[model samples]
Target: MLPSTSILFLCFLCCLSPIVPTSLNLTLPHQHPDPEAVVEKLQWKLNVSLSRRQMLGNDGKGTSSGSPSSFSCLTGNPIDDCWRCDPNWASNRQRLADCGIGFGHAAMGGKGGQIYIVTDSSDPDPANPKPGTLRFAVIQEQPLWIIFSGDMMIKLRYELIVNSYKTIDGRGANVHVTGGGCITLQYVSNVIIHNIHVHHCYPAGNTNIRSSPTHLGWRTKSDGDGISIFGARNIWIDHCSLSYCTDGLIDAIMGSTAITISNSHFSHHNEVMLLGHSDGYVLDEGMQVTIAFNRFGEKLVQRMPRCRRGYIHVVNNDFTYWEMYAIGGSANPTINSQGNRYIAPADVYAKEVTKRVDTDEKDWTNWNWRTEGDILVNGAFFVPSGEGLGVLYAKASSVEPKSAGLIQQLTLNAGVFGDPRDSVSVGFSGGTTTSGSSTSNNGGGDYFGMIFGGSAAPPPPSLTITTALLSLLVIIILNSRHPLLYYIHPLLKHST
Candidate 1:
């Protein structure tokens, strides 16, 4: 039999192993070293940014109509407000690599990649586009920071399949991806899409398409979501405008995790966003998404979003209007809604924002869904059901919920950065005018190159709770029978 110390050590590990979420598998990729650690880092960054803005003695208020030099560094828009208004923004391009918030805080996309300019707007050939086209930039084998040279609208003839390690920055141009196919990120990782307009995406597929510089595949009929993520991880989608999609504005599925969708606008669409694939798709249970600081505006229907069995953080966004409902779900997904302003439409029957689709109270009531500090306007109401407040709060993965009053300021600058070259008019759906702007080098990066770009390697594999526990069990059993197990002998010697 094993000695007392060996048995105790094994017991300790086994007891601790069950802390792993039920959705994880043995080969989970891009798992954080410690998610709590990432969250802590994000909190610290946010605090420092806010504190610095306070020290400057100027809030992100007034107007974006003035010259770029006079723009407010802190726009009161939580995402853009954090770093958009600094006059030195053009010189600090890589600061955006550090500006990621929520679950995708670690997704440093194309941080060390070479800058690739998309100078051509024509996509005369979908299968083989010109070297300077947007399609060409995304399919490159190496990491690339893609930027546009000027204002151009890309009417893609096919879905733009993107490869790994890319950042499509549309800050300096009036770039719009509309009137045709949209973006597809599948089986790739570490992608950042910022400051572009993706709207009116129509479906186009059932043809051969180049996914990368090396491989071309026959794609099925595509659902023209503004963005579609499948089997991908470490993604950050920020500061874009999405609307009028054939399908979901954005959708993540097939075990995709570690994502943050922040500081963007979505309007005039049905089925806005979808977090997981389906109820029976067990791999999605491992999905974790952060939906923060976005705007759901102007004639949107339901599923903003309809989730499956994943953990989602919906925080500090502006829901301007929802016709049927705002947030819906099935399969007992855990939704933590905090500090958002949900302005329901005048339709009395649709005032309720949360929908437990195909689920009765007896089932979904046991699901962990909580609403904290949310402002429900125009008779908007949220029906929450789940564990007690203490239990739910303890299990929540997000930062402390901020006040609902801050929603306007947090989401003030939703959508892509406005071009200083054009005049913009500010308006609001509810009762407040949000701060708006159209500039590229907002606060984080310089116009052309950011400092954080490097040939950064993907993060090392992390230990899951289940894996740790199983290893401990094997160690214990071996130690009990063969105390001199060769592999563990060193550990045993150290212990002794």
Candidate 2:
């Protein structure tokens, strides 16, 4: 019998040795990364930090506790409140005060000793005084009109001209000004148009080209623009949605500055936002403008605001399915575009491999498309423009064939010629020109010269001929050393 210790040691050695396969092996398919995890990681890096207390609000002092009488009173000298001692104001004040202890005095001071009338749907007397119809009375110190209602709709027959300091408190209402040619604002300053929906006001038959431009032009007759701010300053257009218009959604034409357009949605129009028109008063340069956190939707084409030499800060906006270029700036306007998600058309990635070759017969010397760090993938070269050309599409094989041809054509078109007189003949083939040419070829001898002229020597023919051959080689290499090659052969034999 073998030694007992030796026998145990031999058994241990056998267990530790690698197992030799008696049959074929198998492998699994490639697994893609999780998209949700990618989105979550991106959000984690970009989410703005906010205090928990700020979101919930101060203990109890911030919100109304029920009694209108207990409502916090407003206090500002030369206040613009429309709620005061008017008979209409008293009735509206009492109705709200009866609700509870917190519903009385307006948080923003009420206007003193002026009657501002608001037509109520449930009032017995249409013209006479009614509770809540008075809403808030404005002190007539500075020519003001105030209207208040919750979800109220009002129709106007004539144009409403607001000349002085006017505040129309809709109390969050859908204010419809219909059959009126237009609402004109003349020499108005410090106008606050907040939380109101103004719509469906079309231009009249009068071709008053001075008052309205839509009547004169043949293509300008649709629902008309939502709001027109002419000769106004310190304007705020917030939390508003403008749509279904014939012209632009928001027209801030001529001499309107110090504008802040935040938290708004613009869609369904020819021109979404028009800053200054050619005919209007020339807006001065360096006007401060901020466009933040707005969603611009689909089917909108040519959405550019023409501002002359203004400072524009466009940040944190989502643009989807845009038909043409999203934003264009003229007059050397200072524009900063950051953190915007641009989704390309869907059909650009349907094919596995496509080859495109640019045979520039007309200008063989000008192969503009060939640039440094450009990669040719599966017989297709993907060249990007600007600094970010390769960062996003860095992979060697994923660029489309058509993109390569487009970049090459651009390169060739920008080349220089040997003869100064003949601009088309870029870069000399070691020849002297009639104009006493310098030996350095300073103008045409650089990279720019190569872009315009054909290569000094013809590139190896194998460079073009081997593209398809290389692709086949890659396929054969992958198949020969495949993880499950052993199993695949056996499986095929078994099936046969």
Candidate 3:
């Protein structure tokens, strides 16, 4: 095996290599929907997600189980509080689709599709992918709730072009797409990628790759992003762990919008996330993204989403560590930061969380960048620009803001792991039982009987009466014949 330094050097060389595409395949898909309508719908979803909490009040830490080491079933956050803690999550996986919040709430990825199990881990061919492989599962036309038969590491020879209406669900098993080309969602819609690990991706392309059953196109070199969203909308990436890629860990550029990245962990990289393609690219002005309930942890540098022209809502995330700066942008993006815990580094000069890249103060001072209800520590401070602004910043305020004090509870389970005992620690404190006791996983959700290292298979949550009620509310709204916003507004109408 090569050293980590040697591996990084090779990845760098691969990224710099020039590989051009010779064939143009026009049948895949492309979309540039109007951001005005998309943001209005997103704004509505955020309001509905908030409506339930008002109905339930400010309680999150539910009555504890009698066990000495037990986690409260409800975590006080709207998304997770929607019965993800129900021990039956493994059997009723489709229910997870209705719990989305923020901009990507409407992305119902493969909710009604067949459950396709990936039994093979090898990607022997990029163009003619075999059945039972993950590559084949994602490129299919029909909606699919894709799952892994067991723990597998799928390395690709080229970027995995995810088709629309697909959900890559990695709940009961450990799924990894690493050590080569990673995922690319270009001009697609309604896609969800959850609970997977994507890392150590080097540039892989410059060859023929298949996107669907009959279409294969020449692909140029990729940026090796863990997940690259290009001209795609209505996408959600949740509870995934991303790190150490050749380029940005997650880059949504070239007119992507209506996206939410929540409950995920990011670390050990430079230029962590890029929200826009370029300053001169006018199409990216339509981008709207929500970064919520995520944990940005150790060994990470700047660009925890460096923005361009767009509307970005940064809500209730835990920034326990960062060098240089945490949030950055250029091209007069409207940034609304609310209820995040920002702990700056020891360096005095790097305390500010916001960076208006390359632009002079005269131009950036007029930008609508404001931090509300944020908790800054260790000499950390946020420079609020264009305060008292209502219209543009309100577009970014689609998501409701929780108190930063609740960040520890909101983001405790940011990343994915099969067993709690084996989960990687982000070095931030949270209330959890490492004993792995009191959490039961019985019946057919055995997870191949291998995930828990021969112990009990620990799911995300255990059940409670409150969580059951919460789940019922979500089910009612999702199943209602009327539009979602109409149902939620009346429910929250009587409340303040």
Best by TM-score: 1
The regions of model 3 sitting more than 4 angstroms off are: 1-71, 387-404, 417-496
Q: In lDDT terms, how accurate is model 1?
A: 0.68
Candidate 1 shows a clash count of: 19
lDDT of 3: 0.69
Ten-residue segment with the worst summed lDDT in candidate 1?
446-455
Q: Considering TM-score, which of the candidate structures 2 and 3 is the better prediction for this target?
A: 3
Using lDDT as the measure, the top candidate is 3
User: Per-residue lDDT for 358-404 in model 2, tens only?
Assistant: 22234222221122212212112122122222222122223122222
Where's the lowest-lDDT run of ten residues in candidate 3? 447-456
**Off by more than 4 A, model 2:** 1-117, 120-145, 154-160, 177-183, 205-223, 279-282, 304-306, 338-496
Give one digit per residue, the lDDT tens place, for model 1 in 369-393: 6665456565677776664122323
How far residue 114's Cα lies from its native spot in candidate 3, in Å, is 0.4
As for TM-score, the candidate ahead, 1 or 2, is: 1
Model 1, TM vs. native? 0.74
Q: Quote the lDDT for 225 in model 3.
A: 86
Candidate 1 stretches with Cα past 4 Å from truth are 1-27, 31-47, 58-71, 76-78, 388-405, 419-496
Q: Which scores higher on TM-score, 1 or 3?
A: 1
Q: Which lDDT value does model 2 have at 31?
A: 12
